[model samples]
Target chain A: MAARSLGVVGARVVVVAAAAALWELVTRLAAQPYFPAPSTIVPRMYELWFSGPVTHVFLTDDALDTFPPSLGRLLVGWVAASLAGIVLGLAIGRSRVLSDFLDPVIDFGRAVPPPMLVPIFFALFRIGTPTQIATIVFGVIWPVLINAVDGAATVDRQHLETAKVFGLSRPQVIGRIIVPSAMPKIVAGLRLSLSLALIMMVISELVGSTSGIGYRLMTAQQNFLITDVWGCIVLLGVLGYLLNSSFLLVENRILGWHSRARQNA
Target chain B: MLEIIDVTHTYGAYQALGGVKLTLAEGELVCVVGPSGCGKSTLLRCVAGLVQPTGGRILLDGVPVSQTPDNLAVVFQDYSRSLFPWMSAAANVALPLRRKGMDRASRRTAAMEALEQVGLAGAAGKYPWEMSGGMQQRVSIARALAYRPSLLLMDEPFGSVDAQTREDLEDLVLRVCAHHGMTIMLVTHDIDESVYLGDRVVVLSRSPGTVAGDLQVSLPSPRDQIATREHETFVRLRAEVGRLIRGNQLSPQET
Candidate 1:
């Protein structure tokens, strides 16, 4: 198993390397100002983010200005969206009356594009992290809410019956049975929302003043720092990959039983 | 004790149970048997307070069962679905005990004891998916036992396992029933199982199900899987229950 995984990793590395080489050749030959070569972009990315002293873990001051604020907004917005979506989803999923009352509104809310709401949010919050966070939350909350509703609504009938028979209180039933039963879908929703959150973060930053990677990308574009813009895009891709990988690691640990149970079934 | 007084239930236009009446004495093990779609499960659910009958009512220990009684637990047929997949065997058993107002230590102790009683002490740390069908059913039973319910309801609890495992679970139920003196109402379609595990067998008619017959089981105490099944009394009782179920099928009833 270890050898097979190592081989897979080796294959992935080779594929990425080959793709980078091809991109370098094409872009260098084209000599396009808009598309910088990977060699220059890679060096520029290092200069922007990773060339700091050892005291700051090799992060330059630019890195501090770029990553933390954007990441912090993303984290805060995602966490808020998660908590609200799950709580509301469970309520809507479990209660027929509530779902009946709120479903049309939820559908309408999720229908409007979130980036379009950024301007409205800017009007409300006046150009700060609050506006960006609202944009991310509104953009990303639908997947979590919808998936959680699907999960909680379709909880096994026998499980609920068993809970009822055992005389579990309402809170006890929700905590012990409903939440765990809904977790697999909730985690799936969270994963999709994470990527959406990243997209929203960038979109929110692009239209407003900010100290974030998205703002950096916007500034580089306006100044025609083509290499720096490429570097920022590459950094975003890397950041997204790292976030998804870490999320999957945590998901595997928590949902290990769900997959095994499905196999048994 | 449980009393079902003319319990009638309907799902839309379809009547599932039509004025079914039965009663269980404390510490008695009664098996409800009938043909497929006879609404034995519906009757059980009504008693468990999962569904409200369209007409009539069910009473447990002289109180009307508006919701699940405090001292009651149910073992469902599909153990895989009934048991929480994320929880370990011990945790599943202990989950209901939180309402019992026991401290964490006592809950753990109770869960462990119940697991040990079901011959699953070593598997306490294992999740439901980690165990075999029979073992998972055992965990389900352990969960009910840990709740220490005054009344226990089981709906086709052993229907999913192989014959050998089924026999083992039947005997396990017998042992636990005797040991705890638990008042149990078990629903199954299997005549032999009804005769083997029940102190009395209650038969329901086909769809739009109603009580057709109730017969006493007179098999010897400490029932053995092989020896008791081979007993002449067991044979006669099972045949009688089978005849009742068959007779119900012959009668005209709306699908």
Candidate 2:
């Protein structure tokens, strides 16, 4: 197993290297101003973002100006949406009255595209971090809510009966039984929302915002600095990849029991 | 003490149980036997307060059981679903004790002791899926034991395991009842198991079931699987319970 995984990693590295080489060759030979070669883009990216004192962790002034606010907004919005979604989802899922009342409303809201709501959110909050955060939370909350509802609703009959027989209180039943029972679904929803949160983060910034990667991408494009535009795109891609990888790492650790149990079954 | 006073339950138009009556004294082990769909499980559920009968009532220690009673636990047949997969064996056992107001350390100690009672001390840290079906059932039994309930209900608890495992679990139940002095009402379709495990066997009629017969088990104490099965009294009682069950199967529905 160890050797097989190592071989897979080796193949991934080779494919990435070959792809980069091909892109570099094509762009340089074509010499199109619209598509800068990786060679020039790499130097500009390094100078813009990574050249700084050791104390600043190699972040230049532009890097400090751009990365933190965007990341902070993304994280804050995502966490808020996750917390609200799970709480509301569990309530709606477990209660017949609440579900009956809210199901149609949730369905209608989830159907509308999130990007289209950005203008409305901007009108409500008026072009600032609030608007951006509002846009992100609205866009990403549905997956978490839908999945949590499904998870909490479908808890096994035996588990619930056992909990009842033991005379568990409402909180004890929810905390000890329902939440853990619903975790596999909850985690799936969280992972899906994380990717959606990243997309929403960019879209929110692309329309309005002063200092984010998305803002940087817009300015670079308007200035016709095509290489910087490419740099911003590459940065967003790296950010998305890192966020997803880290999320998976945490998920695997916490949900090890779920997968193992599934295998056993 | 537990008493069922003419319990009747229906699911929509279909009656699951009809006018069933029984009683269990403190520290008694009674096995309820019947054919499939005979409402043996429904009867157990009514007593455990998992289901409320449409008519009649259950009283635990002179108090009417509208909700699940204190100091009560159930060991369900589907151990895989009953035991929480996310929790370790010890954690599952310890979960109910939170209601007992046990501190974390004491809960852990009590859970360990219960697991040891079920002969699963070494498997305390393992999750339910990591163990065999019999082992998982043992964990569930340990959970009930840790709760130290005044009453324990088993609804076909050994039905899902292999024959050998079922025998081993039967003996384990007997030993736990003796050791803990817990009042138990075990439901099963296996007639021989009813005789082997219970101090008395109560047979129920087919669907919309009612008590058909009740017989005392006179086998020797500290029952051995081989010796108890070979005993004349044991054989006679098993045959009697079997006859009662088969007779109920052939009879017409009684109101």
Candidate 3:
């Protein structure tokens, strides 16, 4: 099992490396000024992270390190969205009355294109980063909330009865039974929400942020600096991958019993 | 002692139990035999306080059973569901004791003791789904025993297992009841089982169910399944129970 998993990890590494190489080759062959090769982007990514000049890339002549502010906003907005979505979802799913009332509203909110909300948020909040963060939070909360509610509501009736028979109170039942039972579904919802959060983060920054990877991308586009645009894209992709992988690791750890049971069966 | 007085239960418009009366003395194993949909389950549920009698009362050691009495525990038929799937067999057995204010280590110790009684000490760490149907049912039985209820109610506990497992479970119940001095009320559809397990077999009539006949078994205690089946008294009791359950249609002279 250990050897097989090692092989799988090795294959993933190879695949990622090959994909990056291909992207670099394609851009180089096309002679696209906007698409930076991996070699050019790697050094820039390292410099941006560790030693780049601290100034707005658009406003300044030199490289403006922007990874920290972008990462910080993404983390805060994503966490807020996740917590709100899960709590709301569990409440809505468990209560038929609330779910019925909120269904259409959630549906409408989810259906609206996230990018279109940027202007509305900017107008409402004036020119602050909170408006962008709010836009991302709004975009990401729906999926997590919907999934959580569905998961929590469908906890096995037999198990619930067993808990009642054992004299578990409402909170005890929810904590020890409902939440654990609903975990897989909640995890699935979180996965969806995570990706959406990343997309919303980038979109919000691209449209309005004075500083962020998205702002750097926009600046690169205006200046026709293809290498810098590619670098920003690469950085965003890496960040998104890290976010998703970390969530998966946590999910695997918490749900190890479920996976083991499945394998045994 | 447990006394059920003129119990009647209704589900919406349908009357399930009507004027059912019964009593169980301490340490007595009474089996209730009836056809499907005859409200045998309803009677058990009423006793367990899982369902309230629309009219009448169930008194356990003199107090009316409003909710599940502290000294009562139930073994339900669906063992897979009755035992929490996520918890280990020991944990499932220990679950009821959470209400008793026992600490975690004490609960674990009591659960292990119960599992040992049911011949499932080796399976303490296994999940319910990991064990066979018979073993899972034993875990459920172990759970009931761990609770140490004065009045133990089992609702068709072995209904889901095979004949071999059913017989094994029946003997296990008898042994546990004898050892622990548990007063058991077991509801089953099998006539042979009713005779095999119960000190007294109570037969119920058709829907809107009421007790038809209650007969005491004169067979010896610490009964062996194979030897007891061949015994004259066991044969006679099985025949009498079979007749009684089939609407008691035979004339008294014929019986």
Q: RMSD for each model, in Å, please?
A: 1.8, 2.0, 4.6
Going through the candidates in order, state the TM-score of chain A alone for each one. Answer: 0.97, 0.95, 0.89
**Compared with the true structure, what per-residue lDDT tens digits does model 3 show for residues B2-84?**
99999999899888788899999999999999878789998988887778889998899999989767888888899877777
Report the lDDT tens digits of candidate 1 across residue range A1-265: 8999999999999999999999999999999888889999998889888999999999999998889999999999999999999999988999899989999999999999998898899899989899999999999999999988888999999888888888789998899889998999999999999998998889889988568988999999999898888898999899999999999999999899988778877
Ranking by DockQ: 2, 1, 3
TM-score of each: 0.96, 0.96, 0.88
Interface RMSD of each: 1.2, 0.9, 2.2
lDDT for each residue of candidate 2 in A1-265, tens digit (9 for 90 to 100): 8999899999999998999999999998999999999888888999999998899999999999999989998999999999999999998889899999999999999999989998999889988899999988999899899988999999998899999988788998899888888889999999999989888988899987898888998899899989999999888888999999999999999899999888888
Docking quality (DockQ) of candidate 2: 0.84
Q: Give lDDT: candidate 1, residue A222.
A: 94
lDDT of 3 at A111: 96
Clashing pairs in 3: A34-A226, A89-A149
Model 1, range B57-84, lDDT digits (tens) per residue? 7889999999888988999999988998
Task: Give Cα distance to truth, residue A20, candidate 1, Å.
Answer: 1.0
Residue pairs with clashing backbones, model 2: none
